[model samples]
Target: MFKLNEMAVKPVMIADAGFMYAAKMSGQASHYDLFTPDAGELAFLADEIAPHPFYTRGFMLHTDNKVTDLVQRAYEHENAAQYLLVKGSTDYIMNQTGLLFSVDRPSVESMEAIGGTGDTLTGIVTALISTGMNIPAAAYAAAKINRIAGLYANPTPATQVIEIINQIPRAVEKVLKEDHGGSF
Candidate 1:
């Protein structure tokens, strides 16, 4: 539906929320490079029979403990992109083959209650991909960066997403210096 082949440059396609739903519904999910789906959304993608997220089977919803199963199901049904960044208590970075990595350390529990944290993650991954980083690496880095930003924010239930976002620069600096020998 996107007519990606007609584009002069085939840009890396990353989808989340509504865009991700469109990709899955269009049966063009394979055309995308990455999908950032939270656990509940992953259920929607995994339910091949469901026309939309709201219709996903009750049994399949919010099964965070079975994320690997959901990932496998989504891929088997061709409802996922080439790569997936499953965001939750533990962020899972995966490719079509299987799970590649997981990031759970430096976890900021209060970040979960804060709105837009996931959106921030999608933005970070998009920026990393735009810089020409491969999808999987970008996803992994973005997960780490997001968590670091949240840690820097020291968020509370009262904290706003803008507070976490404000720490992004410091987070980026810390991640690059620590993970990439200060050269990224």
Candidate 2:
């Protein structure tokens, strides 16, 4: 990862799932700029003793309500990145200091049952970061964009991730127009 810092223009690094696990295991999670984890994965990060997500303690409930506590624990254990975008029913954007934003509006309940929603969120955040937006702001905006996309897709139990993916352009346009005055 040191090579990343060697670049003339340092890239904003974001990790999810397996990459996040690798970062935590290597004791270098702080080296990255952002981590996008669902509550279950956050539980893994919070458990400093857990070697893998499967080993996360049973006491650490993987529920949306426990997100704040798990985030604190993850930071306390130094197993979190500089920024965390906890993806769940209510997406949370936070840093070491505390929570910055929680996006649950335009809620699309059906999206939860569809696979790749969390991955889609991470991708949106990455794209936003690539556009020169600050990590925290990108995370917040990405959450909004993702939910908006899900809403536009009108997902059902059978909705495919590609259906949501197809709406990303419209979602980005809507979010930027509404939130950023039609520009990134």
lDDT string, candidate 2, 53-157, tens digits: 989888886345388889999999999999999998889999999899999998899998999999999999998888888898899889999999999999998
TM-scores for every candidate against the unseen true structure: 0.95, 0.95
**lDDT of the structure predicted as candidate 2:** 0.91
**Residue 84: error of model 1 in Å?**
0.3
Those runs of model 2 whose alpha carbons end farther than 4 Å from true positions after fitting are 6-8, 62-65
Report the backbone clash tally of model 1. Answer: 0
TM-score of 1: 0.95
Global lDDT scores for all candidate models = 0.91, 0.91
lDDT of 1 by residue, 104-145 (tens): 988789999999999999999999889887788789889999
Model 1 clash pairs are: none
